[model samples]
Target: MNPIDTLNLDFRALSTFLAVLDEGSVSRAAVRLGVTQSAVSHTLERLRQALGDPLFVKSGRGIVPTRYALQAGPHVRQILDDLQSLSAGPPFSPATAEFTFTIAANDYQRDLLLPGLVKTLRREAPGISLQVIPSGIPSAEMLRKDACDLIVSPHAPEATDIMQRGLMADRNVVFYDPDYRKPPENLADFLKSDHISLVFGTGERPSFEISLNARGLTRRNVVTVSNFSGLPEFLRGTDMLATAPQLMSKHLLRDFAWVPLPFELKPFTLLMLWHRRNQNDPAHKWLRNQVNAVAAAMNKLNP
Candidate 1:
């Protein structure tokens, strides 16, 4: 398109483009924008003419964005964000503003970090609600798909669209019930006992287990559970030891004793990850700050 044509293009068409991309259908975009299907179609036509591309094309049963559309989306979202900030309203008040925030957390981190976060939110941001989903391996695609507002986990996602900050670093520890057995004093004792392993994903090994295997060492994994919360049940009344992050202290109240792992293992760093789209959102920023503060306090206690 010519400079004149570009200048004449309605900025509203970008909103239509974004809505259509987000909703994946013209009719849905119209509903989200409180407009008619014809209006959305008209906007798309104008955008196709101005931008010299189909922008969106019919797929099997729905429309898929063209390469150009996908490429332009982040910039378009940022443009709209800048415009909204230009006409910014009164400062954000969490106490009065109601929002449903979603986060992806591993069971251990969820148990460790969320209690403090929820406590603060209840007293301060009473109107806000939190939704927590299980965190497997966090990915950039997960963020782009709006899978969660933030991800709290040890593995950093390798997507350019996602940004992350280190929350804490944790080492492995042996957890065992005193009634059933004592803490392992060395690697030989640790290897002799049966073990419970927390498997975050199917067919995947835990870091501590992998580390042990790297040194030609292996333990008898008698019980395998998906989350740290389930470790106690499997370890109780048995001579099984579970090696997990130190953060488990915040979540576990069972009559369990813990000691540092007898074998050398690398520590894992927990991270807070979010999409760039929500990076500048005031409410998102505030929530991130609050969570970061919570992480800092927890790190001090655990570290």
Candidate 2:
């Protein structure tokens, strides 16, 4: 379409296009949009003339998006999301704000960063509350579906609409009970010893394990747990080694002794992730800033 034709397009037309695209029928879309079927037809006719695409085609007893409509869906959604953010109005005030922010995080991140964040929120925004859920190898859908407002994870799923910021970097370390076993002395010793590791709810192994596998190495996983909280209990009496992020030493794994890994593996960055739709929201921006500040403080103390 030419620029002049595009100028004729407006938010109402775009919104109607989305409604039809999502609901799959003009009647259904009209119902969802609280408009009559003729109104939807009129808007779609304008959209068709402007965009020069039929957008949707009849398929079986229902409607299906044409190639052009499928391609335009994400862009349309993004535009509408951006426009909605403009209505957020005024800066956020934490002191009097009373609302809860939900975050998705595994036990490791929940322990390492959130407690500090909670303390800060309590002091500065006492009226604000937080609810946290486990993030098992986070996916973009979690943010897209609004399952959580934020995610704290070492694994960031790749997607254009998802945004991430580095919280901290941590290296793999070996944790074991000093009374039950001595540290691995070499790569061979590490391989020979029985191991305990974390397997997320999705049955995906941790990045450290993936790195080891890439190098044609494997460990004898004598025990596997769903979350970091289960590690110490299994490692306490057994002569087993648990390789995990070094920063965990300050919290969850503190009761157990940890040492640098016997071999080198690149460090991984823990990240905070959110959907692009929330990018410009004033309250969300303030919450993100608080998370960053908490991570910064942790990095300074740990470093």
Candidate 3:
């Protein structure tokens, strides 16, 4: 029989095939899909018969996709994504909707936007809950893999399928405790003082740090925390300084004092990102509008 004529797979089989291809094991794919190993095996058998290829082959103790499966993966994924977009069928009413939206964001963006978002949801859509996850240098795959519905960050990963909008812009400022030390008045004073900085898990340096290093300006970094939330504890009682976005002073670092950086640095804009598939969905569009409104209000308040 012709392979095209034999193809009679349903959405479930296609989904299971992609799951196994991604997890590289029937057992692991079963766990991901919340099905038994035998069920996953049965689905794969159907997919193999339909496609006229053994999609996965045992490689050592694990499994790997064959060339045909590898070639078919993107097409299958696009098909599923298109089908998902179709599920957003009826006009969405926030007041009656009941679903959880998972968003990927770091502490800085989380503290800056989520609280306001929570309030808006409570007032407008009480049934819709939110799940916030850490966004480590936002990637398009996070959306494609269904890892998150949205991502808020300063960095937007380059991808044709990902869409982004600028939320707010803030200049870098020096954060310190007034009781512990006075603000540095000059570049020499700024560089001489010990510093506390954020170093993310990805080991990517912030733009200001990269620019500073390129200019041959180095501060004495006495402490490096993994996230912005960890900065205040290390800085509260010491003479150390941290360079962070000025907008943080209103929320996460509200108790602390912040001053203009001794040296000039360009402002960074926070961006909200989502997959293009979600761009036209009414519910997703509503959430994006709320985030945009919150960012606008924050900009007005700070300006």
Candidate 4:
């Protein structure tokens, strides 16, 4: 028989053949497959005609596989396994894949996460390029439209349909200049101090204010900045104290002094957010794992 002609056999027939072989009876195979016994027998007939072999035959009460059927079973099983892996998408190969990933993160994250991530990428996958953008309205929209690959943020917006994984936990710290004398003992004292608020964008301000209102204190914002990088600079000359993620403030505290926020607030969970479309993508999965690993390592070091 020509090889091309042999390739014309129906996959359904092969599946039915395997089912019958495994079940040891057509009736059992039909029940397993939710089909009539006659249909299973008919499928076996077609498979036998295509292969030019009596793939299985009656031997007493149970069906017996012929030599050809026994030989073909493992090969058929391997083929099906390979097809299933392909459907799920194969594992990522970082060395050969030339792909660009766009990530959204705030400036504080850019300071803490990107430095270590970049060093690892340079050593491992030099071809993969990364674009980091400010996390805000644009980032949320980009994620929804599948324009951005991932987002690293303290809190994910509820409006977007994105999957989030907690990367690291950090509390909000109140940062002040070293020479600033007033040390706050509680929420009332903290509220009395001038504050510099870090606003990602216009949308974040309302939610942030609402969260503060729930605590029975309204933030009397002396100044608002677009990025966290400016917070350190803004603190140098003014009495204004800044509230930011602990990890980011930890890096800044090398040159400045800070204290824990007096009011009881939830610890910030920095999360990685990605659209559902790329949830199972091999390359995307690899990147997500790398980020998770880095965050885990950093947490271990700090804790």
TM-scores of the candidates are 0.73, 0.78, 0.73, 0.65
Task: Pull out the clashing pairs in model 1.
Answer: none
Better structure of 1 and 2 per TM-score: 2
Q: What local distance difference test score does each model get? A: 0.82, 0.87, 0.88, 0.74
Off by over 4 Å in 4: 1-91, 137-141, 157-161, 206-209
Candidate 3 — worst ten consecutive residues by lDDT sum?
A: 1-10
The TM-score, computed over Cα atoms with residue i paired to residue i, of candidate 2 is 0.78
Better of 1 and 4 by TM-score: 1
How do the residues 86-198 of candidate 3 rate in per-residue lDDT, one tens digit apiece?
A: 88788899999999999999999999999999999999999999999999988767887789999999899876457899999878899999998999989999999999987
Q: Which stretches of candidate 3 lie over 4 Å from their true place?
A: 1-87
lDDT of 4: 0.74
For residue 111, what is the lDDT in candidate 3?
A: 93
Task: Show the colliding residue pairs in model 2.
Answer: none
Query: Candidate 1's residue-wise lDDT over 14-44, tens digit each?
Result: 7788888877899978976778999999888
CA shift of 133, model 3, Å: 0.3
Residue 268 in model 4: shift from native, Å? Answer: 2.4
lDDT of 2 by residue, 70-164 (tens): 99999998887878677887678999999999999998899999998899899999999999999988987788778899999988998756899
- Candidate 2 regions with alpha-carbon error over 4 angstroms: 1-48, 51-82
**Cα distance off (Å), candidate 2, residue 266:** 1.4
Regarding lDDT, does 1 or 2 come out ahead?
2
